[model samples]
Target: MENKLKFSQKHPLLFGFALILTAMVLIIGAMAVFNFFFFKAHRNSFFGTKVGVVHINGLIADSLRITNWIDELAKDNAIKGVIVRINSPGGVVGPSQEIYAALQALARKKKVVASMGSVAASGGYYIACAAHKIVANPGTLTASIGVKAKLTNMQGLMQKLGIAEQTVTSGKLKNAGTIFRPLTPEEKKYFQSLVNDMHDQFVQDVARGRHMDIEKVRALADGRAMTGRQAKEAGLVDELGGFNKSLDVLRLLTGIKGEISLVQGPPEKSSLLEKFLGKLTFKEQILGPRWVFTYE
Candidate 1:
């Protein structure tokens, strides 16, 4: 020890560099240990069965994260079931369908339950239909089964501002949904047909997911939002309850006498700019061009 102290005194700079390197190694090791335990706690338990949770919060603008969560839960043998907790008014059609599809695939491997929060309608309900069963609070707003595309005519505003612009397209319908002017009759019909087709697809998926007849679903798929109780009465929801009720149903489905641990995906990380803007810049609010159709 005296010789090491003498050596350190003779090479203080080298000793300081070695101390920093040792400190860094210790910190890295501590972080690794912490991450390991954290991941284990979230994914499984040493003494209980596990149930994974997939959160669908706010607008359903993107499916990659949600789908990846579902897929991870599906591959995890420790996860006997999954709960999809939804608190959204819905969003774009493509992402909603993707989430639904991912849930459906996961359902085949494990029991899946949908739990609706305050507002789970339109695309939210669409995704829930893919679950084995759905539970919603009686007062939850849900089941707005329809598609819509909003278009704005900026011609008058532009005229008032004395702004003029022109665009050239290969086809007459190429700019059918441009905000510069009102749509022509033909363009209107074309867009209407598109909306109708998407709406029909929504109804079909709902009917299939809920195991209800197509005609029965059509009766309730009028683009009007319904309360959870109303949806239950209309055969759109499997049960009328909240998150705990859904967990109970999951327990019943899994039939695990042992304790059940809930696992959830990692929280999403946001950039400093996104944090500053908050949800005002959520992807759902500004996802696409004027012609983009949505399940909102």
Candidate 2:
């Protein structure tokens, strides 16, 4: 009764190939699930005393935000400590304060540390002031305690191009920096007051953060950059050492024995992309030292 030469029985090789393909798909799927967990688990490191390096490696503009990164450190219980590594020229007033506030808030939950890079001046130091401790290299450039407002007077350019600007406002200061006209005395006084007030705030914040006298911080915060060793002398920083030394302090403070994880505002690999983009706009190129997220 030579009945059943079943289809799969007759062609075992085909069945074997199907089984192999199914096994491979399942394996790949399992790996993808594992990867998802791995990434999510590492995120906890940001909040722990895990020595996460927050790189502020650019201009100190009001728009360049760093608060979001700090917020991450705030929430991560494993991130018991933080190291804000800064290298910037100290940008405008408003943005720098935003970063300082984020650090201040984060400090409530965890100890924050500052690790200055090649440069940490003006707004960079402003951002660093919020940290409980500041570390820098012997040649680190830190300090730039002042406020600045850029005024581009394009009145002549507008006249040359025969461009006329029309405006009607309820307030006299509404069009203070309008490109069509030069600044008036009233406008000058108004803008100067704003800059001066921000400078005073900067000095006060520094003095309070470093536990130095307001007058002393005022003297050193003359919008001038300083070497790390010199900064240590002036009480701007606690010690003269690189990031490793900062990590040692972090380890002592938090007692975490894991590899340092760096969570920067923007990735360094994107720097080349920045250069190409920077050529198109002056605002885009300036490195800012400020907290980024409004509520990160």
Candidate 3:
């Protein structure tokens, strides 16, 4: 008891400092936990005025998540406008079209602008058409308005390995894209017709969105990519500028003169273990089933 008393008397200030430090660490940890659970609901309330920013990065795949997010933002009255930041080379046909449709629906209700980064080609540009305005860097790769279908034949490799496979199907076209055999001339024609139809659909959407003649869009929709500056000249893009410039455009369109709050969609949730495994198997997941029509 005497020794304890002597130590406390000699180090009272140090003891108080340690106690305060420990309390601060605990407080910070508690706040982190609270924010993780309740931040979405509280964020808008914390910020007086804000524009919701939705990022459509990497390959444009499934649209359910993105569509749901846009719907949620549409219902939120606090979000004055929306900015869709796209950085992609494009992906599957169905998902890209779905995303474009969703964005078009959102545009009817609120002002939505598209900002391109790096490579936003093919279906990336397709979705951008749904926005009220599109902003891109001068050198940004913006337009590759077309579709592509690729099927790899593994018959040669299988024969080299002395392996053979057989399949049974109800219809001949059911196995149209099978890797074991090459496509017949008739099958090739069928696939070409399908691609041409999708191309026409893309052209119609672009013409409608940009208020351009269908013939003008059709002439340029020959699976050719161009710089953002070229796209602007062709009436495919609204402005040639970077992300910050896109925010400025949004500010002007919304008429918000003061400070603007930016709200972004929630980050994708994945476990550390899942992320590690995903890295190992990303290619297979991204390019599932070799025969797919893409806007890449």
**lDDT ranking from best to worst?**
1, 3, 2
TM-score of each: 0.82, 0.72, 0.81
Counted clashes in each candidate structure: 0, 26, 0
Candidate numbers sorted by TM-score from highest down: 1, 3, 2
lDDT of the candidates, in the order given: 0.88, 0.74, 0.85
- Winner on lDDT (1 vs 3): 1
Segments of candidate 1 deviating more than 4 angstroms: 1-47, 270-288
Task: State the displacement of the C-alpha of residue 84, model 2, in Å, after optimal TM-score superposition.
Answer: 1.0
lDDT of 3 by residue, 1-296 (tens): 99867877899998788789999999989887787577855644345478888888888766666888888888898888999999999988888999899888889888999999998999999999999999999999988999998888899998899888687989887778777778899889888998999988999999998899999999999989999999999999999899889988988888867656678874574689866664555455456775788888
Quality of model 2 by C-alpha lDDT:
0.74
Candidate RMSDs in order: 5.0, 7.5, 6.6
Model 3: runs farther than 4 Å from truth? Answer: 1-48, 273-286
lDDT of 1 by residue, 140-201 (tens): 99999999988888999998999876989999998898877889999999999999999999
Task: Give lDDT tens digits, candidate 2, residues 1-296.
Answer: 23334756888798789889999999988877775577655544333335556788666543333676777768777656778888786665667788899889988888788988888888888889999999989898778677766666787898899998889999999878766777899998988887777788888999989999999988886677788998899999997888879888777777777555655453443577776555444344342311111100
Per lDDT, the best of the predicted structures is: 1
